[model samples]
Target: MERPRRWLEDKLWSSFGPEQASANLRQALSKLRTALGEDADLLQTDRASIGLDEARLRVDLLEEVVPGNERIELLEGLDARDPEFEDWLRQERAQLQAMIARAGPKEIRGILITCRVDETAPGRDRMTCDVLSNQIGENISEQVRAWRQADPDMIGSTDAPQSDVMIQSQLVHEGNGHMLFIKAIHQPTARILYSKLQRIDRLEAIMQSETEIARTVFEAADQIVGKLPHVLAKDRPETRSTALSRLGLYRMFSFDQDALREAYGLMDQAFRHDENGLYLAWSSLIRLTQMMELAEADQAALMEEAVELYYRAMELDSDNGLVQAIVSKVRSTAFGDTAGVMDLARTSLERNPTSAYALKSMSEAYMGSGELQKAFDTSARACSVARSSPFKHYWDTGHCFISIACNRNDEAIIAAEAATRAAPLSRPAHRSLLALYAATGELQKAQSVAEKMAKIEPGFSLDAMVNDPAYPVRTLRNKGLLEPVRGLL
Candidate 1:
């Protein structure tokens, strides 16, 4: 991501005055140019910003890791004798270590398939289950191998024996038929990345024709493989575009001003690497989330950029249910198009009913359109469906707000607590908890949460919230259920 020259000075030369920092940066850039005498053009610079030619650089920190290079230190022998530089380097090293550890062993592996049939099933049913499991597994494995081969990031390890994805199938007999469950688990997070449940009405149908089942399996495999790039991006550094997008998500979830800016920059870089519509959706979401979190933030630029990104994402992938779900989330905030937002959310849900993301968007749209009961109900469903998923915190946060809107303080408190546990740095989560606690007359707990929020977001205080009109005091007051907390704030 490119950095504004002023940001660079503040980040790297924090110990120096503004004028001195600028001069020092100039000298540092001059020295760097001299050091890279033959490749100076790679050090890109404009009047206000500085960046590397990212396209021409395969930064080891963001690229594929060698099979046995986990122990190697980043920039092993390089050091700058400055406190800010040391802090930045240490942070990068720690983040890289965390990513590698999460990725598990470096040895390449292929997808592992496992099947189970209920031991109490009839002998004939068991036999049928075996045949179906093996056939489906074989088909899925073939497609997975083909997918790995086609991916530029996994070019050389296409023949690995095992995969990061674990496809598990379980068959259990019902009264007159059977239920088949297939789920793809991303090993690193132990999360079910994709799942499908099917009912077999008659065993004879399977023996006579496997066409319907085959088509279902094929579609499941396609969707499973489609999710791999994103799952791997979080674990593997080499999937640069996906990695940036994943990191951006974490940063945005923090709901901090500086972190939101960093998230935007990361998503921007990721979009440049791969014009994936989802990246644009994520970027737009970051903007909207930031505006919603910080009541006093300048909204004009954020709103404009968010709407533009949403439209661009639609142009790029209008049919993608996930993309539509995400972009629709910003519509209510970005343009106050409540009806349009609900329509988009409905379309997204129609395209992918199983998507918890679409459900979350729909819940928010319902609230925007003054359907509080519908918002609460949909938010609850979204939370239920997103259980143990990678982004469950997002749904939980939505549920917290909807529950509060419905005067369900206890439920709102539970959801808010869960959100904070999932993303401890999130200002919004802490703020919600603070309000809930205060409303319930848990003054001590509410004050503690306020302290935590202050730590997460500097300058945040109950006094400021009470005195500042731009703060969310008015919105919280309008919620009605938070009446008891208004005096406390």
Candidate 2:
């Protein structure tokens, strides 16, 4: 019997192949059937019955060859094979058990449909049912009724053969029924579906219109400016100038002096006694003086106008720090005076000590005026104060720069490293690292830092560094920084 069983097994093995044949056995079986012609059914039955091994081999083969409805049918009838089928059944059961074990607990409990129709049609016969608490169910019914009334044809006609449809009805713990029905008509053609999706809607159309209008306005403004020089120098320059003069003194900044003076003369003739006109005239004069590089006269005039603007801005909002800060910086730079700028900055700091801009200005002013210790102290304080801000790295880098300047090499290295970690992309952080590397005689480290800096700022040059008025060239030269890397620079 074992000899006959072994002969049968060899025949089965020849038909079913090896254990790994389960992988694509279905495709092989289909080809075998097609090749065997009239004997295909007998071969299939023989392949199906060479014990559980053959049964399992058949199950795997069926899974691949028949899909959807036929696959479900084969699975349903799978248990009706011989008694030896238990082993193959055990294998499948174990596989399913493993899959379930891997799935763990679902976040939500519900039925999951693994297969569905690809398309549905409008208007055949359909039924929808929902199980829910009475009140919620009634509410849903009312909404459905409303939907039906609003688009009765669409709702009624969504049952066609080959229509696109997805119907999901879920019941929840709160006694609510959620029913999702998606249905569409069979597309006339693939091209029609593509065209429908690609078409722009009303909102996009409106945006395109607004963009075109903005472009037209900018072009018109450019054309006006291009025609100004010709119009202001022609035979009827006075009339044209008079019309342009009405645009106010701010307009003078937009024109050349000759064109500006002509416009101004027209304005003076038109409204000589008006205070606003006088203010405009004075403002234009001050601007022209600045443009001509009459710095002494422009400084006096600008100071007066700035004071007036500051007062006016204050009247609008007395606590406006931006206006105050601007007035302070202008006064400081114009007259070489630090009193106003320092006072204003200190006041702002008292209110919001973490204001990075004010802290930066105080540091720069102190540094520029030969007060390295004061600059270092101010920057350290700023770093401490700005610890909570997202821009803390900026203050950290500032403090590191000051530390390097004050010859605190260890402290500077630590600060520079922290700055790089905090803001890896910051130019100042990399520069500070380079400076620290050069100071510590780490020539290779300094070269690496320089390479990183050059990658970020491709236009950076040693010539630019030497000519930079802000940096101390003497100290840079003395340190031999950027000297060895001259060829790369």
Q: Considering every candidate listed, which one attains the maximal TM-score?
A: 1
Tell me the tens digit of each residue's lDDT in model 2 across 365-457.
676566888888877765664454444575676677667667776777787787777666555567657766765778788778777766654
Q: CA lDDT, every prediction? A: 0.70, 0.41
Candidate 1: the clashing residue pairs are 63-238, 64-238, 109-162, 110-162, 110-163, 111-163
Global local distance difference test of model 1: 0.70
After TM-score superposition, the amount by which residue 232's alpha carbon in candidate 1 deviates from its true location, in angstroms, is 6.8
Candidate 1 residue-wise lDDT, 203-286, digit = tens: 765544344564455455545544656566444333445556666776787777887888888888766655667788888988
Please provide TM-scores, in order, for all candidate models, with all chains considered together: 0.60, 0.32
Off by over 4 Å in 1: 1-170, 174-238, 295-297, 480-489
Question: Highest lDDT, which number?
Answer: 1
Backbone clash numbers for all candidates listed? 6, 13
